[model samples]
Target: RMELLEAFKTYFQQGVANPPGNYTSYIIKAENISRLQKLAELLTKNHIKFAFGGNQNARGFNYDRQKEESFSVGRNDLIVNLHQPAAVLADVLLEPKTLVSDTNTYDITAWALPYVYGLNAYASKENLKGLYPSLDLSMDQDAKTNATQLPLAWAFSWGSTENAKLLIALQQANIKVRQANAPFTIDKNDYPAGTLLVMRAENERLDKELAKTISKIATSQDGIFKTISTGFVDKGKDFGSDGYPLLTSAKVAIVFGDEVSSLGFGEVRFYLEHDLNLHPTIISVQNINSIDNAQVNTLILPSGDYKDDIKEGLAAWVKRGGRLVLIEEAINGVIGKKGFDIKKRDTTTKKDDQKENFGSFANKSKSNFDDAIPGAIYKINLDATHPISYGIGNTYYGLKTDDLIYKPFVQGWNIGEINNKSLMAGVVGKAVRKSLDAGLLIGSQDLGRGQVVYLATDPLFRNFWEIGKTLFNNVIFCDY
Candidate 1:
């Protein structure tokens, strides 16, 4: 599915993929604003109630240009909408009338251009004369990096999931890598804490043509390789300092259970293999006892159930320097257990349980189930100094489906927190609004030599959230 998606995204401009059904989706390859208006007028004349949306973010369904943030260049995605019959298209929207409301149907059906046709398009309320350029998809990927003189090491800004791919690709090619734990200025460019560094001293006997080998690997992964001259930096921590740590090849195993979220599991697998180019060992809950901490360093448990023995084994593994990553509701497995136990926010109160309903029984029952969060986006406040937040900014946007709130861990670092649990997008119930007023989104609890990493929300929601993907990569690569 990801291969097809990537192919569609890569070749959609060349008219390679077939348009699903008969929906008027287009790419404005011409640098003409009037072309966009002409198409909009045609739809308007047809009396089709349409909306303009950015090509990137899945928000802006029934999009109002005035209400949403301006979809400017170099900022938000400027993609066209997938126009179909109201009856067919509205079935996937996140409204009450949306047909795919079974919760088990899909992760997020919010309209996204990349998931749909993978092109740059836009519609406007007014004839705003925006400087639009035709996207040149035929550019050479090999030209991404120049053949610079081989210095002491190589480095690149680790701000995107693409950077993670480069790091993984280098490691797979048997190239040793190191990550800077502090900021540094090389030449004139200032890199943040999570900047990936490939030192020559580490990979001396690995390859004969080392510089070209790394450049080629980086180009294949669509990463810009910046050559480092000397370890001595103009400012910030130097390489000899405790700022640079050798990155280890990820020895990971994802625990898949019978009742575990297939969506979450699939997302983890897809992001790890398809996106990041790392193949993780697949472990079933029945085989949880088979997990040898000596063989695997990181154990990822998606949202699902776990037996007492499995949980107990996980606690011991974590104490023995094994990384345990818990996603969404999976944290419930070890919440009350020892070694990995952490405090959860108390949301239950007498006000809701008491007889305070003034509506019909049918409506009351509907409201009870309606409290289940479908999906929503929220602002995250992160400790920028922390390694987990190296590439991402202080404010990270995450898409959350469940109310898996946790209290701050006194012993561990709350790398990122949602100070205000207000909805940036998507619908939410009043009860959920009050319950998730504020909570931790990303944290780590130190058990012994190992740690239990917590992700309160599904970062790779439906395998879309680009920013969230970076955060997820941090959980795997940077949070050592």
Candidate 2:
């Protein structure tokens, strides 16, 4: 019940657009000791009508059905059942067909209420698939699946994306917005035969006339008004092979460090495999270490302890103009250290450090990590408005406890201080980096000819896990 109430608060008060009319809905579902009870109490305090029916029956109302319209319900007769079946709830809320009237509004004649609306532990597999079609374990489904995801709705949100659009509009209202590349691969020849290209007239006057002309030009175009093309190239095969000016070449250099095979190498490879035209050369520095022959623009030093000479060589590489990205602790401990202090002691027992402990990498699924990291933390300042963050939303990175940077039981990660004094922000929760402290805790530093971006936590790599791909993508693909 509290979760439902929180959902209501999230929808109504958390900056989401509201419907025209003030509609009050009484939700019924299985009640456990969740966030629902608190919500019910809050609603009661607000004088909102709420009735709870234990199990299935109460006051002559069937838990599964909406009372007939002919039967009158008093203002105080709100009934909510916690144990009704989802099918019954759906039968009460969603009408089979929508009857549209002259006003373009719907008159739902056979509506049914849905008890459960999203995927959860209590949800059946079929229902979860139905609710999240895009997440359907099949690629056969079409755009219908994509349209249902909450992310799409957020794209046109009131703030982030919308604000960017408004800024663009203000700068040059008649200017055409174009995509550097199509979201999906599409050839110019594949356009429909009847397709037409329409351009808005370049006008100095920023008025409704210009807006109307743009609309008219758009309406006169081909089958439909798809996204505009900026003529910029993307990290696609054709873009890479042709070698456009907007594109550049980069090679990833993997330096041997802790969790080398398990963490560092895999991440570097993941980028190369997914991104077209990007090449990488792996250089293991376990023995004789020198970066002189490492002809690479970007170097990734995975988390681990290394010899002092290796650290010196890396510093030299940076001084000569190479981008260095480091994770966890490496030689010399450039970041995240109380101070430069090192000590060693013999193990009390000769049992090799008490037989070591092991667990899942970051204790998260790949997909959850993918989405949660970017959306979780807050106040991620860019490196002086660089191309990586151009037209990109400021994102938060997620750090799990197992990663070397994780601090156990610390409410949030500490992004370095502003001016070396104020508190740093970070993500506060387990999945999403939702706090200012977390962002500050995982910060970036620029030095010499090289740029060092510190990802405080290891970003999980599975398709469903790496929520912060865009953040990483920007860093990797930007024109730095």
Candidate 3:
């Protein structure tokens, strides 16, 4: 799919190391759709050198045919198959060993396979080691020997799909991992069913190394991994003190369509299914009228140009006790609609009779607002007492990739707001002041028996901003 390819390009550009003269080849095997067209366009826009070939079946192209078809193809360089049944291309493609294989090369393989599969399959460390000898996959021998002793363990909630990926990645790196047989509690926080327990012997040196590997993969800018050290315990009296409620029954629906303007749809979908472990149903705008509302409790609208009919259906659903989460451009779609708006006050007129209320205002008038700061990081002050802010501290970091800013809604309860001096770049001399209506990063409003949540910028943008993940999880689990 084009969405998958776009996400791959973003990951390659931002996270992976790009060496000189190194090229990547992706083997896509599926029915050609509009997504494939988009993928071709994205590859061209990025100037990524690539070749495309496919047929009605797997036997259409043989080894000689593939080579003859593309004379530019080389055998010595690395090659990656995006999806399986790799047997379709295996005859023509070079093996990993035949193409300059090493630990670094294997490392890329480990990351790339996971990216392609997303949340579809799970690969254990032993399986990975058996497959790739170049991977220096080895678990601490003492750790396995002293497994029952008072060893240090890292506990990750099973609800997070990102955690699952991390668990797999760690395993691929030859680290020892296990799921808690029972519910466990660390400090005051409760971990639910299927919580991953990353354990190692209490060797300070090895522990630090393990931490580094996780940090490299997780990449939470605010240092989420560092904060877990204080709560480490093997068999404390407080173990399993409290149980976290499972959100398995809660169903979340994400809107997707043929809208050409849609952005962040793949990121949102990936984060929900892969990071949050919430398998969300993809609802197309064309079929919105046919779907049953009772099956879905929460609906997510990603940044896109939505049809008016789709917007009306969502609005009507929210009024009937269905929760709505609007991100970026979708925020504008629900403008002047029920339970989501800025509630702008007239600043020009003093007379009560001439007063008027508006939903949105221009951001250029504000001295603190910067127009579209790409990759800018900002601090978000969270209301810890609120359900959506549960388990999150007073403040966490959020990423902004757009220019949109709103005059904060005074009447609505402030669930999360941008902190003073929150600007990370652009116009460095200008001071970011706290205003009654300045940077309202996130807010909630009661609509009938349900709730409407609005986010000015995407918290799960590219699934890179790790600190905002808990807040997004809260949105999924919180009862509105």
In terms of lDDT, the best-performing candidate is 1
Off by over 4 Å in 3: 1-248, 258-261, 276-278, 287-291, 339-372, 407-411, 425-437
The sequence of per-residue lDDT tens digits that candidate 3 reaches over residues 2-92 is: 9999976765554223321112233332121222233334434644333433221111111211221222222211123322223222212
Sorted on lDDT, highest at the top, how do the candidates line up? 1, 3, 2
Candidate 3 TM-score versus the reference? 0.45
Cα lDDT of model 1 overall?
0.63
How many residue pairs clash in all the candidates, one count each? 3, 47, 4
- lDDT tens digits by residue: candidate 2, 1-480: 999988766654432232211122233332211123333443455443335332222122222232222122222222332222222222233221222232212221211222111000111111111111011213212322332222201011011212222323322434432222222233342221111122232232344354344443323321112322332223232322222223223456766545354555666566555432245676766532356534677777666655443545666666666666656454224533322122211113346524553646665444344223221212233333333433322333233332122221133212321211111122222322222222233444445666666554444333222223434544444444
lDDT of 2: 0.34
In candidate 1, stretches whose alpha carbon ends up further than 4 angstroms from where it belongs are 1-145, 307-309, 350-355
For candidate 3, the lDDT comes to: 0.47
Which residue segments of model 2 deviate by more than 4 Å?
Answer: 1-247, 257-261, 274-279, 286-289, 292-294, 307-309, 335-392, 402-439, 461-464
**Residue 372 error, candidate 1, Å:** 2.7
